[model samples]
Target chain A: MTSTATSGTTSPEPRGPRSPGRPRSERAEKAIIEATLELLGEHGYAALAIEAIAAKAGVGKTTIYRRWPNKEELVLDALAATSVPLGELPGTSLRDDLIACVEYVRRSRGSRSTRLFPLMMLEGLNNPRLRERYETVVLEPRREVLRGVLRRGIEAGELPPDFDVDLGVALIVGPILYLTKVWNVPDDQLPDDVAARIVDSVLDGIRARR
Target chain B: MTSTATSGTTSPEPRGPRSPGRPRSERAEKAIIEATLELLGEHGYAALAIEAIAAKAGVGKTTIYRRWPNKEELVLDALAATSVPLGELPGTSLRDDLIACVEYVRRSRGSRSTRLFPLMMLEGLNNPRLRERYETVVLEPRREVLRGVLRRGIEAGELPPDFDVDLGVALIVGPILYLTKVWNVPDDQLPDDVAARIVDSVLDGIRARR
Candidate 1:
């Protein structure tokens, strides 16, 4: 496996023979992550139990415990593995990049993992440890990706140098989240060009006039 | 007592000796509502139990049942009783009124009931009945209040006649919610002038400059 290949510095033939247990362990890990996500979507964070996850994954509790110390870490891994990365931006223009980010959010509305986001937030309200991990592991990375785009906009003189990047992120992200999470606007009901509309509206307010 | 007064059309004197059951029933109702809010804050919606609420309130389950048909309705009442209505707008300018609306949201940050909003939203995701009731009972009223403000702004020619009020509301409300709910920005960390900042930012985008 990749793990063995990366770890074997002195091995003459890294790919010669896979360990008998390696493939089964990898399958178990995937099953565990899938079960974690399914339970979270059905029940939510507080009600999620490690034993239940083991049962659903058809693995022993010790296998799950060996992989993740607790439910939070397991959940964090599941989210990280499943989350759609921002991917390569077109580098065309600020408006295009912003539209891409919003479109990413719009597309996530259909996924079960995306639906668990609010439940995770609810649990984070009470658990500081999980909250910190979630921020650093899941949320901050996504925000940084968007921040990079905004930074490019500023450097290129597409936006004012004094533009607040954090506020800009909130402005672009907030309305769509409100529509999907709070308003529970159905997918079919959402405008096809919502990403463009939001990006343009925010761009008009933030972009400096020539 | 108001219920008694409103229903006593045949009574010669509406203020005559109060029904003994009425005052005690009112007190029981108050206790139940308090317990509901407390448990909801502590455990969230999915974990909330009517039996537990009754136990906490020092009343029988039947007492709670008599007043509210189910946990959702009880929660709706508890939220309604505690929710801060947008009392009256200044009607001075679109900028001022929007600031007031945003300020209202800012002030709600300190309330326990306000904290339960995300939990309620999480529950609403799965339960269509609860979602509809929450929208009609709690969310719609607040949206309507903000909607009224936007309507006035359009009428006063401060905004374009074609202004998208729903979109305007989403733009103004979304960032603030994102800051408080998603980012979990602490109260002290949030600027005192956040309301003004958000309103001005959104107004600049939506309002038609002369």
Candidate 2:
């Protein structure tokens, strides 16, 4: 479905660059997205309204509606602007790759990741459109990146022969999600050995017998 | 300021028992509390209105307001009904306690605990009044139940010497919260060994280096 030819030929989203003009005022766009995130942090996702965002951005609600259809869609666009692109990592071990993943979460969301993310999560629970956008755009993209590194590990005989790469990925990172988002103690709240503690359990079976 | 004492010294409220008349209907009180939980489960704390609950229960809103002042207070009462009373285990090892804990989660919230509980957690996140009520009514009660077992385990040398009991609780239950509230996966979708995996990790550690 994604395969397409550029320009004159049929393309779903036009793979090649379009002939552009000034490109929608990058500074204004950035400011609007930043305002949306800040509001999500302070007021939470449910309380957020487009009228409030437009007011905070010093733009009209019409301007926001002109750009994005509704609050969830606007949140999608705003989130897209701020999230890490989940691209490549080093050819190093799985440890390094996982480190990069946690580091990405830290850098992208900053200290507020633990605080603001639950709002998005809880909102996703309530809103179908937001949930779709969250799963597709926000979550899958990151999962895909980690899956690539795991796939490489499988071929190289680094991971166990029957290791479920996907579950392994989840196992490695799942603690971070649970600790930060649920408990609110956060990964950052732990002593320095927390990451190492996590790595231990995932690699070795936790059974005292094992 | 919970000293609205009736005959009991521990009266946290003027919920003064058995007003000297036709003995306030036990049937009415049970039906009201049940209706409140049902509404809370169906429509969450914010959407739950006193008028609606009273109408549903075939009682006056004054009856409800007489028992509880506001939605927040009523929700707290409703939460108390839903939360499992703790210290029901066989008094064995930490594993037994944990298994009991997981079982308690199931009994308290049913198999769908994760989905239903998010409403409470998210509301607590946003509402400070709810936070105090939450800790007083739910979190602390449960923790206190487990605390005795953990102390016994420490004496008997089951859990590690340095184990953080509160953090341990969070870690053990954290993934359930993540999968339910953040990942929005159905509770029946829980991986089979999930509880075991978390328990093992806690009793041991996750780190390969450690």
Candidate 3:
């Protein structure tokens, strides 16, 4: 299938000499990203091939090449496309809001992510460009959202004015990540009330109150 | 050079007929495990070769084959040998005890661990035996220590009777693991007071007290 990039009405008409091919289309971009994720799950980083990605995507090899120089770049872009925005959670309290964020991560992480996320983390260590992009595009955005929530809570006097927001965020989210990745706890086996439990434990530490 | 595992006074005299050559020596076993860790640091899991490990350790390939069925098993054993026993920390308070544990991990994880930990985690996912040994030998032992500390804290009335000990342990250790591995944050860059701050954050949450 020869997928072509179609220019939407918002795209300005070509002012200069255009490439002798169809305009780029959002449909093809989404297809390529989805294909990259599927291939990553099945084959991992070492075996992922551009030709296979193009074939699975149902687009010409040139379509992928024009956008990404190599499989690493392609994979980075594919992951970035899946990054969720965490700005609009609806909850009556900080505890509920935190749970909402955890659920969002749970729901958004596809099966492919279960197998592929670790590979990307390992691969990113050796490759500087990939590491930077993984942090900036994939990690930092989600962290910023958490920060935003904490800041809001502090301002509303829901939290202490001197609260260490950064550490607060880490305490809230870190255990879930550790259990999932390090301990290899399957999602189903994870405690049903993990989010609530984490919030409670962190909010009121094991230390006895006066 | 070919090495052998020799029986010592510690080993009971062989009841059955033994091989003609010298018994497997404990010295050669230690050498081989050390070599495996060094190679893992330099080449990671995919490129690690049993032959190279044998050569580096100055033992015969047969020596490695006799003990471990494959590279993964050998690597797992090498890591297991390095797991620290956390039983003797001399801290006056639960907070001090937790920090000591954190410091012990920070000190014990060598450069090899920094390079090799992620590879082991990624490889362990597909290999169930390695994963099981990883949990039993490497992960669970450390987790058990944290459990012991929390239990001790509760017994002394340092913490509330109803405190969630399991979640408390996770909250204590999870952020450090997450920052080090997932974010790939350099050890030097981690705050010196991380343990104290985590302890504080969990004890008295960011939430403003009534």
Per-model TM-score on C-alpha atoms: 0.84, 0.70, 0.79
Where model 1 places Cα greater than 4 Å from the true spot, the runs are A1-24, A208-210, B1-25, B42-49, B60-63, B207-210
All candidates in order of TM-score, best leading: 1, 3, 2
Compared with the true structure, what per-residue lDDT tens digits does model 1 show for residues B1-210?
123223314323334444566888678878998999999988778789999999999998866765566787789978877887667888788888888888887778757667778778778777888888888887888888889989988898878898878878888898888888788888688778877767766666554232
Off by over 4 Å in 3: A1-24, A83-87, A106-110, A205-210, B1-27, B38-49, B83-87, B107-110, B205-210
What lDDT tens digits, residue by residue, belong to model 3 across residues A106-131?
Answer: 55444455456677766766676777
**Against the true structure, what is model 2's DockQ?**
0.31
lDDT of 3: 0.69
Sort the candidates on lDDT, descending order.
1, 3, 2
lDDT (tens digit, per residue) of candidate 1 on A126-197: 887888888877788888989999999999988888877888898899888888778877877877887787
- Each candidate's chain A: what TM-score? 0.82, 0.71, 0.74
For model 3, how does the per-residue alpha-carbon lDDT over B1-210 read when each residue is reduced to its tens digit?
Answer: 121222221233443333445345567888999999988866666779989998999998876776666676678778867555455877588778888776666555544554566777767766777677767766787788888888888898777776667777777777876666666667787788877777665655423221
- Total clashing residue pairs per candidate? 0, 5, 13
TM-score for predicted model 2 compared with the true structure? 0.70
Q: How many backbone clashes does candidate 1 have?
A: 0
Model 3 misses residue A73 by how many Å?
3.2
lDDT for position A80 in model 3: 64
Docking class of 1: acceptable
